[model samples]
Target chain A: MDAARFRIRRAAGGIDADAKIINRATLSFVLALLGFGFWKSGFDPTVVWRGLLVIVREPDILINDYVALAGLGPAFVNAGLLALAAWGLLRVTGVLISGPALAAIFTVAGFSLFGKNPFNVWPIVVGVMIFTWVERRPFKDNIIVALFGTALAPIVSEFAFGIGIASPWNLLAGVVAGLAAGFFLTPVARGALDFTRGYNLYNIGFAAGFVGTVTMSALRAFNVPLSGGFAWAENGPDEILPFLALYFASMIVIGLVEDEDALPNLLDLLRTSGRLVSDYPRSFGIGATLLNMGLMGFTGSLLALAAGCDWNGPVVGGIFTLVGFSAFGKHPLNALPPMLGVMAAASLTPYGLEAPGSQLALLFSATLAPIAGAYGPVAGFIAGLLHLTLVHNVGHLHGGLDLYNNGFSGGMVAGIMVPMLDWIRERRRHEP
Target chain B: MNLDATQLMRCGDELAKYLYLRGSRRVRISYDFGEERSFCAISAPDYLLDEAERTRILKVFSGPIQPEIASYYGALAGRRRDGAEIELLGTMAELEDLMVTEGGGTQIVLSRREAEYFGKRKKR
Candidate 1:
């Protein structure tokens, strides 16, 4: 555990100690979960251990990977840092580690598989730490949210690495950029919560939009164009089948463990479409939420493997992110329909659905669950379809500063779709 | 818990809108602020509302501020006899939602006079 994870002041109930235990336990358990998927898929844990050794022993591959494909181990470390960070923050701050906080932590971890890596995470984390020092609050205070604020981790990594900045200077530039992004994001996230009225599930997504716009604009001054016209991620039956089974099974176990009798209520939650600020823990208890997180992890893992995605660095990180959000506002009921819609659109369009990164975009971009949750499945489907088309081009606008690409996509989806749907409803009402 | 009569009136309006949205026929908003017994009733079913839509209002309550949104529902939940249609207008979720959106206080009422002075309102 890093200092952030262990930096809590003592609480009345000794929750600090319990939190530490749980945090470490959570890390180990999640690692085991990843290890299981990795091992099951014929990637040996020992081999992965060897791979980890290789990563530390030889840094050249990472440098080489900068342009091609970033690996997953770095993501796990990044996410692990977040989890430790969250635990530390809660312990020190004495504020409970909220569902959103937990969800955010998981999201950081999961996305680490895809876009976030330890190399990228530090600059953002350090920036947040500096924010704590400046704010005069303990670094652990609100630390949980700050950890998720790392949605911009990619900003630091890619900027430092992608800009052709070499070696020590490359990391320095990335670190500076990342910390700036992190320092900037924390307050913006707090403020954006009000605008969305907690009606948008991904407040961070909304915050990232503005952040990306600013960062991208700043980058653009140098003619560093960040966003492009469009892009798509991948998906398929293989992923769908395995993930569907794993997710449902986990849900069943969760249902059974939490309350076999809780089904009607749990099912009712599904009927709700999981709108923003939906407190499943308050409504259904933490057990069910945990079950959801586990299932989401299983499902995301299956999605990754099915895509023939390497269990390497970036991919695992992405899976962890998807899994983490499962506990926050991205339940399958709230998330999958949009995914399906995106996939459906990808199939028919000139943009071949199986195109590189298209399915990944579609799968991960389900961050727009608030659209589906608030409006129902049809709108969710539509939002997903639109999200896929727009996500690619929007990233450059933020100059890769907004690390949550889907969040950028999500903000657009929410900003546009919410009003349009409301208008449609209001028009119908007025017409009749 | 000094009650804001004006704010109470706004709460009434929101309650009215909520009732309308739920596709219910009639809703009765009431207040039993010790000496005061006040209530507002809406009879239009065309005033339907989607549960997702809500207005935030600040209410003055005494004690732990246990606002019984259920009274409206209990009043409405029974049979619609003699063209009588009734449904629960406000619920715990509404109160919690209102509290979150409004970010106000639910002051404790130690006495009736204090109730009238603090967060106190009775809709009957």
Candidate 2:
């Protein structure tokens, strides 16, 4: 019956309250993929299933393992799920969720376990929802803003738990701040676009910079403690790799079920800018998009593996994100140079070419795929080199306040590099 | 105003349909600037455009607004054009200019600068 309901290309707006049906199907299929990975990792299917069941029922009991698994698996799952949530929000509201919105959701979600969570994120969502009501436009219309708008999720969460405020005061101030953040987000996003121009993709990073700046100020004015974070991971490739396989496999399958012709559409996807409003589902159908996604995922995953980077939580999240953006703008044609440049730079420097930090630099820096897409391969290589350097060091500028370090770094890289690149090109043109 | 002839006529017809939908029957338009600036304007009675009807007309101008435009509208809604003296409000100049260009059943008048300046703003 569930299969009957969501017959791939046969239905529109699927994933309804027929939750059990899809849930069962998704769960079974997901677990099957999981089982294959665990088997490959030498775990019996029965044992893996029992462990996962316990993991699901009591997340805190397996909090250590679950968080470890979540840190890696959830990046993709969160981004994919965030996308589905956007899709659902769009389907229900008739608004087209913007690319920036999708990226924002993924970015914030990737940071959630440590910094953001369902509790903190809700206020931001609620705030944005209120703005939609007042504007007389369906919430979906501002999809990009709504999604990218979640950078403030940390503010919400920090307000909820970080401060020494009373529980009631904490929740109240936290939620109110989020709503105010949401209310002002649309206009602020619109207002800030000009300050940097289109060179920066993470306009929300720019928005978040302002937000975090103001938030830090407000927190400072009052007596509130908002500072510091810890790196939490128990580096284990054996456990993490299987989880990565399951998540990517599920995405590939979902994409496959939807694409009618997997082959040609994969080719066509490369031709697109992968910018906002890129509806690969509509343009290429399910099968092709899936194929492309799978290939991209594999390629990105392999890059992480070959780089010998640890397959812990954050790195996996970064890899999943790079692969997902293949549809948006991170095509192999464009993405390779930055990864190559970064690797080249790492190999020569004190940085270990095969290190997690190095891989993280290369992976997240792929967000500047447009440099490759916009300029020639040379510029992209340069952009990647520039990104690799800046991304590693830029976190401190925001005081790790802006969680989309790639975006924050991407903005700076694109902002500084593109103009200089253009000047150089112009000089070359003017020369004999 | 500098649009190709067919594009101009097509724009005119859309204005006519919009005016017709809003219950107007006759209209005229004039341009004060050069051929670059010379164009038509559509005039219709106020609120003669019901909500849906008004929206249909508004969609044409929303076009591919870059973030700059989106932000400009966000911040400058009620402020005049950047270099002009009119000190118009919000996106009023844009809304008015769009009406003038859709020249089938209405008349619109723009100052010399506005006549030449309607579509000048790009992404940056």
Candidate 3:
């Protein structure tokens, strides 16, 4: 009995030690990548500081591309800092290092390059925390959604910074709007999950789109002018693409070192339908999930390259978000069909293959990968086609307040297509 | 069988009540004599039971008395919900749509003999 107890203790100790090492390595990797971006952009503290100040002060409405508005250095710093703060929050909360958390953190980093900024995103988080208190649940349960739900952060910025409202009143109104958005976002997001029934992995994005639309409509009713049109940067793929490739490749190597089981579990990861609540870390382990994320990032960049698109802020943002989501529900096998479908749709339409809209369609179209997983590749392809077509029109409803416009489109597509697919299958089953 | 139809009805009532507590509204419990199994299908269109909850319930299902029905139905003489008389031993099969049950909730089919064994032993 003594020997058995000793062996058990040793085993537990080894497991704990391994977990610590892995966590340390993963955190280091993120910081190092961000540091590289900072250095590569030729770090000047004063310029970066100025850029960050501009980011916070900007109205940050939809398509208000950060790369175009601010320089690359500041945007990188914003993303890195925003992501680091989130990482620190996780550490403070004692949340386990898991796939969903990783996805959320990286998404913050990615979107910061385009839309999210530290000043704009915090109020929503605070609102989510208030929701936890009201619901009498732990904050951990909602942290991931809170991070993802920042797609609507622009609404807060618009109210505070956009309309040229007077100083103190503008600040007050913005705070109120952000708090209200945060408070209501929890229930809306939870309830909206049933609409797509987990087929659309970007569930919060779907919910936030509706929220944004209503908010924008109310603002417009009060005679607040809504801003619309495409915002993009036409430079810097040459500098950014090489960095992204090396970063992802390094992630794969690190993942292999952490777990020999990564490659084998990757097969299992691909087999999963990637429905909601499919937390990969709890099942496949972190190493394999990270490997999948790296592969996804590489593929997204490759797709961008194939389309002759420059790696601008939004493009990189879209690619990084897609990569992060791979840990949740966007594997290569499932994600590829929709990407192809977007490319196909672009060729058929008047839109140039490398047009910003088309590039966005390609990158964000992966949100429908679950449609492929649930139905078939053909269904996924159709969903992608429908997404690009719908996305162009749906932005008007929200007035670009919804940052995850693709999520809104994906949810709509899934809601319509999944039921039809189920009906067809059910009918066929009876017929045979 | 010492367990009469009334007792069986009571057992079914217990299951229905339990499933309702688990957020399933419309439940249908049926017994298959030929296959010696009992099926409980709940009309839970949006029923999502996390893994931890699933594991807890599965443990109860495989135990001496299914906890939800144990107090009233499992205390009978020489009877247990663990299916001693029935070969299935009170196990739940994988969740699926077995024969187009209402509301798309999970269907758990167990041996009827086990359910009977849950109330009373067969008397010769």
lDDT of 3 by residue, A1-432 (tens): 011111111112233444464477557646764685578457778777888898888767667677777777778878888888878877776666555666777788878887899888888888887886665445755677678878888878887888877888987887788888888887788667667776787777889899998998898899987444356788857878877888789778876777777777777778766655344554455667768888998899988988888677788888878877876778998899888999898888877576677788799998889888767899889988888888778888888877888888889988899888888877887894
What is model 3's DockQ versus the real complex?
0.03
Candidate 2 lDDT tens digits, B60-106:
23322222122222332212111111111111223454332233323
Higher-TM-score candidate among 1 and 3?
Answer: 3
- Candidate 1: lDDT over CA atoms? 0.50
From the highest DockQ down, the ranking of the candidates is 2, 1, 3
Interface RMSD of each: 19.0, 15.1, 17.7
Give per-residue CA lDDT, model 2, range A338-397, as digits (tens). 778888878877766655457677777676666676667788788878877776676555
Candidate 1 chain B weakest ten by summed lDDT: B106-115
By lDDT, the candidates rank as 3, 2, 1
Model 3: lDDT of residue A145: 66
Candidate 1 per-residue C-alpha lDDT over A113-196 given as tens digits, one digit per residue, 9 for 90 to 100? 444555666677778778755654345443554666666765675566556676889778877887888787767776665444
Report the TM-score of the second chain of model 2 against its true counterpart.
0.40
Candidate 3 has an lDDT of: 0.68
Among these predictions, the greatest DockQ belongs to 2
Model 2 C-alpha RMSD to native: 12.6
